[model samples]
Target: MSADEKGDFISNNHQVQPIQNSLLPIQHNPNDALPSSSNPRRNPRNMQGLLKFLLETTKNEDGTHDSEFSPMDEERKEFLMNVFESMSVNIAEKLTESLKVISQAVNITQQDDPSDCENALEVLTDLVDEVDVANDFMKIGGLQACKPCLYSPHNGIRWRAAQLVGECAQNNPLFQHNAVQLTFLDDLIKLVDTDTDERVRVKALYAISTIMRGNEKAINFFHDIDACHTLMRALQSDSDRLKIKVAFLLSTAFSGDQFLKIQLQKMGFITLLVQLIMEALEGKKITSLEHLLGALISLSKDLPDALEDCRQPNLNFLNILDNIIQTYKDDSACLETVSYASSIKQMVYSYTDVINADR
Candidate 1:
């Protein structure tokens, strides 16, 4: 089924029905001709008249009410769809007006009133939601709309935008190219390094992880651009959230193509990867430990190359593999670890056979 049909089906299934007989016709209210003494300062008659007019206008021409309501509802839904479609090309323009209104309100309040910040937050949130709606309509365009919000003046806005970007990047590998082309990495790195808001920085780190995950080109690009050091620095940030995100990114990169992995290892990434795993083990940051272990397993798959690059003998690598096998011999909780150990053993044994044959 088409996306629109699916959306409509879901909407119809989840929609709440309006209360029966709740809509009173306009111009037929008993209080239209009466005046209230309790509210001398208020104009109750005028209010009643206005509500009556609205009710009457909403009624069908055939004297049967709600006959036209479904068509009107469908029209409104179509208009909303159009608005979402136009969001990509017109987001910057629409946001300009919204930002201006927010800034004007903030200026009037002079930052003295909490309500000013609340209003700004509300507008910013609506803007982000609109962008997300657009993304659901057209993925790439919606991502573009959210890109500028990463630099928004309000920390809350920046954090939300960063999250949206990461979510978009995670959904499509093509978004990885768009993200990098938009210099998303530069913005995220700056946020990671200089942003005073820890939440914003943490979210930026997550965006980095999302952009890198399952994206070989992005990993190669980062390796070629020598951004691994900056990424590693983020792993050392005080925020455990940022550290975990950075570790995941690194682990993903390490598990990519051998060329990218070798490039990163040549740039001294293996040491950082090992250090991160050790730190995670010690600090109980088990969130990405399995991913890290999988990355290490991939690295171990090419043990001969790593040994040669590090100028170490194959015997040394075998000894490390032996230790791991012994440690996870009967540990049920470490099933993944045991599987990795078995793979490492196989790689070592294969290498030894080849070496002896050459000799």
Candidate 2:
């Protein structure tokens, strides 16, 4: 099925891709001692031992590293990745036990150390990124374990927790559905509404975006929570990071829902999207042009159908879409694909035929 047709699809190129790179930086070191033939670390039998050592080393005993982990030095994170990658299957198999330790470090019920939780989330996020552990993670109550951290007093802890949840929800429909069932998305929306920290808000918005991705049920749940208004407020933020993420969320959620398309246009999202594009054209903010265009394209394709039953349409996004396509045709080749040009071209002709038939 095409991306737009899938029930749980998010573009492979969206900000979710960055979460893979955001948590870990793995580069083999020439002087590292873990890979030697005689190195005990090479033994897969020692994987669980390695995991325990990591947890002990990272736990904060006296707030010495409340702001960060002194033990999680570059050498340590690299070593952790090295060992974890070597035994991903075994670790995932033992994920329930491993989660006990990992969760204790982060779970507010088990620990209150923000630094420990932050560090634990970092490690867990990196692991989830490396493997399809969403089911295993959720199976072991990971969703419940991580939920409290979203409101942690520490910005880093909250940020990392939010990032981890979003990564888990990526491309996993069941996980997304479970997240909604557990009201995780509502908590995240509440984070967006109340968090004073921009970093935390951005992460929360990104997670909501991921959980809502292409799941029609989740998207409907989003409306039930009145998240569209929350997203609109985010779109007006001065932070381009927030704007790009919320715009991309709209694009992903807009892919398969016809009802949402009408609701979104009624909220004036099409005009806001066009304004974002115009800002990019004027070189005011260049970071989100591709995502903004993607959202506009999704909207363009839906507007005609969304408003087909209206007695008198209030606006002509088709005309606006035609101008956008013409204006950006030359630059479209530089985007992720030329499909935007072709898709909009087809939309223009389709709308033209409908209008001519009426005339």
Highest TM-score model number: 2
TM-scores of all predicted structures? 0.52, 0.63
- The segments of candidate 2 whose C-alpha lies over 4 angstroms from its true place after superposition are 1-26, 29-98, 101-113, 130-132, 305-333, 336-359
Q: Mind giving the per-residue lDDT tens digits that candidate 1 earns over 1-359? A: 35653454335243222212111222334644322335322222333554554455454476654444444578545644553343333444443444444433323322344344334434444444332332332231344445556666667667866776676566455556667766788888788878989899888888887777776666665654446666667666666677666656655655657776666566655555555555555564555444555555565456455534322443344444455557656867777755764664464456665476346
How many Å off is the CA of 337 in candidate 2?
8.3
Which 10 successive residues of model 2 have the least lDDT summed? 14-23
Model 1: number of backbone collisions: 0
Q: Best-fitting candidate, measured by lDDT?
A: 2
Residue-wise C-alpha lDDT for candidate 2, range 36-116, written one tens digit per residue: 436644422344455555565545566654564355579657776776665444444344444554465444543355665
For residue 202, model 2's alpha carbon misses the true position, in angstroms, by 2.6
Error of 1 at 358 (Å): 23
